[model samples]
Target: MQPIRVLLADDHPLFRSGLKNVLQADPAFNIIGEASRGDEALLLARGCKPDLVIMDVSMPVMDGIECTRQLKEHDPSIKVLMLSTYSDDAYWQESMEAGASGYVLKRAVDTELIIAIRAVMEGERYIYPTLLGGFHKPGGKAAADELQEEVLSPREQEVLLLIALGHTQQEIAEQLAVSIKTVDSYKTRIREKLNLTKRSDMVRYALKHNIISDKTV
Candidate 1:
């Protein structure tokens, strides 16, 4: 059988390197290309036409969930397996809604990623379902389920996260490669949708809703 053609997208160079080494050691997989951000991943996927893309859930320019949505919209045949350090149910639910074939935490890569890859290649949705054991749990399960009421666009969530992280609008514009005006537009939409204005309110909303955890993405 032909090796499974694979592309990898992760912001951390050390982690990406480690993953490369892992896949390279196995003959069942073929390393095609690597990307450090979601947008770059899309470009590489289009060019290399990899059968599967190992995507990081968080990334600059474009988050992996948004990328996966766009990829599947562009070509439903391409497979995307989200890899993240987060074990939150909201994250996994959002990823599956965005058309990801599977979701796996970075911590579980050693034991479950290959299994996830195999499952996804065989047309199965895979999620390790790690329980959220480290959260503050302000409102418990209902807070997470409230995600069904309203949803933030992936870009809006990205901007909101940057805002919660104390990044200036100018900094966010620079990182997203858009004008400050565009960044403002995204912020306005986010604020309007969530009815959150203060940075602290945004942070609390993100936490209570499980859009973000205390851990770094």
Candidate 2:
């Protein structure tokens, strides 16, 4: 199988070097090129046509969000995984709107970054679990206000909570003492009942309904 071609984009040289080193150690990834600015990244991307671009949110010339927008516009097939220090929901929302396939925080990069990259490469969107906490304000009424009247079964609620807490289908099955196929069925039912098609949307719903507390996970 061909290695996943990747382009690194970050203004900081040291950080870029560190990321390149880490990615290089993984045989699945190939460092096709590196860019120190968003504009440079755009130019390099056009030339290298990498399968993925690991980009910093903040950069000179143009920000990662704008660069991602332009890159997607130029070639919709290119995947972008945003690496950022920011945990703000606004930044997360903006990155998603700008066509990011995944968002991983700098703090959790060592542990979660590779998982996020693989998830996106496999055609699944990846959002850092820590950032999901921002969807609900502490002691605020936003979550209560947004809560839906539709009720879920006990098993479905348990599955939803686990999913929102970042459990994989296999893990959830193991935890709940159910089969993987059963977990998938529960997820499908949850999505249909809530009218949610994206994992992020289900996460938000879980928060709003107090199914999963930010502090708990």
Candidate 3:
């Protein structure tokens, strides 16, 4: 059988190296390329034409979400499996929306990652098992019903995620290219919608709802 051509995309050199080593141990996988940023990943993907890309959700220059979207547009057949430190359901949903074939948490065991890769390679969608507590599948109706109740705007969801990730308001604003006041407004709206009274409450809510994993807090 032909080895699976794989591309690694992550900002952290050590993480990429570790992933490369892990995949190299499996003869079924071939490490075709490595990229340190989203744009680099895109360029390499076009050049190498890897069968799959294991990409970090957060990256400099362009985020993995936008990169995955562009990759799918350029070549729908190339699969993308998002790897992230966050176990946030919002990130998982956004990744799917951006055309990722699978979502796996960074903290997942090597076996789980391999399972996800194989599942995606076989043309099946995969979501980390821990993140699917109340749902039968990646985008199940239970999740949709919960989303209806929250009704957070995309920007608000972004803000809430950053907050749960322990980013200060200023950092969130900087990352989103918005002012601190705008971040605060988003926070206020999120709190009001969820009836949260404190930052800790928001963090708790994020964890309880799988908006973020416990490790993130």
Candidate 4:
């Protein structure tokens, strides 16, 4: 399959360079252009017509949300996945309202950016798991937090997250620096704690709770 064409838009040259490096490291992406301002991004998008854009929220001339709105108006098929330092609900809402296909936090980008990109390119709406809990208050964040402390121990959560990421028990053992039998024990406890019977069910639970969508995954 052809790599996904991308355009990087950020005000900082160093940050833009970092973005370029990350995407380049992944063979699934092809860098076509770079921009330092939202207006410049819009202009470049019109010219290159990339498959997706990794957009920074704050930019000169125009902000990412406005650029996203304009970009969607100009071509709804062009996907925009927001990359921002801001984690506020207002920004998230605004970006979504402006037609951004996904919103990813900058702090988590090194690990979560590719996951967010894969989701947006495949037509799935995504949010950085760090921000997911805030919106679904009373249930989302609270339940996940409760699970971390009360239900699943931190190491077990680590094991569960790896499982959700499609890692085998042996791989998890190597990564976690433990024996395969120990990894098996952790996995068994995680499944039993969640009352899950199948690996698929665990994956679904991990996804629904935003476990697989964050930094590690």
Candidate 5:
């Protein structure tokens, strides 16, 4: 039996340290590395290639949402579990859009996190029980077409779509049959057209404009 390798990423050092101890207490999880910022999380995640990332939704220099998007782009196989204090459905919505496997509220029972991690590793999506009533599932092609008309080109729209789904340029390139440069170009154009000021801002716009469904974005 292979042990599950886990990486802890959060801006709060004490929280991460405490979480590390909590996870290490469980024999099934192995703490492989720790990161204090979104950028560091991306770098460590890429290098360590951990099986699971337990991350915070809020962080500096990059938020967990964008970091998770980049991570999934780098390695779609890696599972991400978002640990957050926010009850805002937007976080839940954005996290799912960013390809996070699970969303666990920090105040939930300790076992909830465990369950979420295990479920994600087993190829399942876990959401906090309290949030289920409000999770909005988007309509079909009509909704997609509305998002498509947001001043982005066909390719740029595709890139924005993938970004909403938590794919990075490299991942989007392979998925769209384009080069990384091509994906970047599309992203640049999309950002400019959308008037997005930051990578995170692009995600927020995708969320605000309903470019991606609430459940996914």
Candidate 6:
């Protein structure tokens, strides 16, 4: 079987090196290339054509979210699994909107990262388990169900979710197969409909309404 060809994208040399070592320890993965910025990651992704891209969300020039958008835009088939310290609901939402297959906090290094990478490669979505459960109640599944049916079109919901996940306009556009202008339009619509002002407001809406529960996607 061919190994899972993987590209590592991050601005921090030490962290990237450590992750490389960890992944390489398992022969199923191949560290094919590395990039320190979003633009560079995009270039290398195109050149390397890896099966997966493992990236850190915070970086110079273009962050992980933007890079995921660009790389996915260039080739939607290439899976992206975000590796970041951000446990924010927005970051989780944005990663999904940006078409990331999974979001694993950097703190969950070995176990969670491995699971996320594998799940995404197999066409599944993964989010850290604790974050997944934080938006839910023990018994009342009704609110969760209602939140699921609320009237955002899948694309609109996709945008909202990514906004919740902490992605920027450029990043959302890249992930959603739309233009930046279109992303702005969606943002306007979302803000108006939700009567929200700040990005934190969106995150609160998602959590409060259970738009993103312990649900994987």
CA lDDT, every model vs. true structure: 0.80, 0.82, 0.82, 0.81, 0.77, 0.77
Name the lDDT value of residue 192 in candidate 5.
42
Candidate 1 residues 81-168, lDDT tens each? 9999978778887998999988888997886677578668967666563332332346875663443223455566778889888899
After the best TM-score superposition of candidate 6, give how far the Cα of residue 95 lies from its true spot, in angstroms.
Answer: 1.1
Tens digit of per-residue lDDT, candidate 4, span 67-143: 99999999999999998999998998799899998888888778668756765886767666546445444576567
Using all chains and alpha carbons, the TM-scores for the candidates as numbered come to 0.61, 0.66, 0.63, 0.66, 0.62, 0.64
**Roughly what TM-score does model 1 have, to 2 decimal places?**
0.61
Clash count, predicted structure 6: 10
Give the alpha carbon lDDT tens digit for every residue of 1-217 in model 2. 9999999999999999999999999898999999999999999999999999999999999999999999999999999999999999899789988999888899878876775786678666767755654565554654423432223545667889998888999999899876787688668656655667887888887887788877866
Cα displacement (Å) at residue 14, model 5: 1.6
Q: Please write out the lDDT profile of model 5 over residues 1-217, one tens digit for every residue.
A: 7789999998888888889888888889899999989999999999989999998999999999999999999899999999999988799889989999888888873646765675578676666655544434497644543443422444455578788778877899899876786677556546544546576776776676666767886
Q: Give the per-residue lDDT digits (tens) of candidate 6, residues 25-123.
A: 999999999999988999999998999999888889998898898888889999998888888778878888898887788877765576467557767
Q: Which residue ranges in model 6 land beyond 4 Å of their true spot?
A: 136-217
Worst 10 residues of 1 by lDDT: 128-137
- Write the number of the candidate with greater lDDT, choosing between 1 and 6: 1
Candidate 3 Cα lDDT to native: 0.82
Q: Top lDDT: which candidate number?
A: 2
Q: lDDT: which is higher, 2 or 6?
A: 2
Clash counts per candidate, in order, are: 0, 0, 0, 0, 3, 10
In model 6, the clashing pairs are 90-164, 90-165, 90-166, 91-165, 91-166, 93-161, 93-162, 93-165, 94-162, 94-165
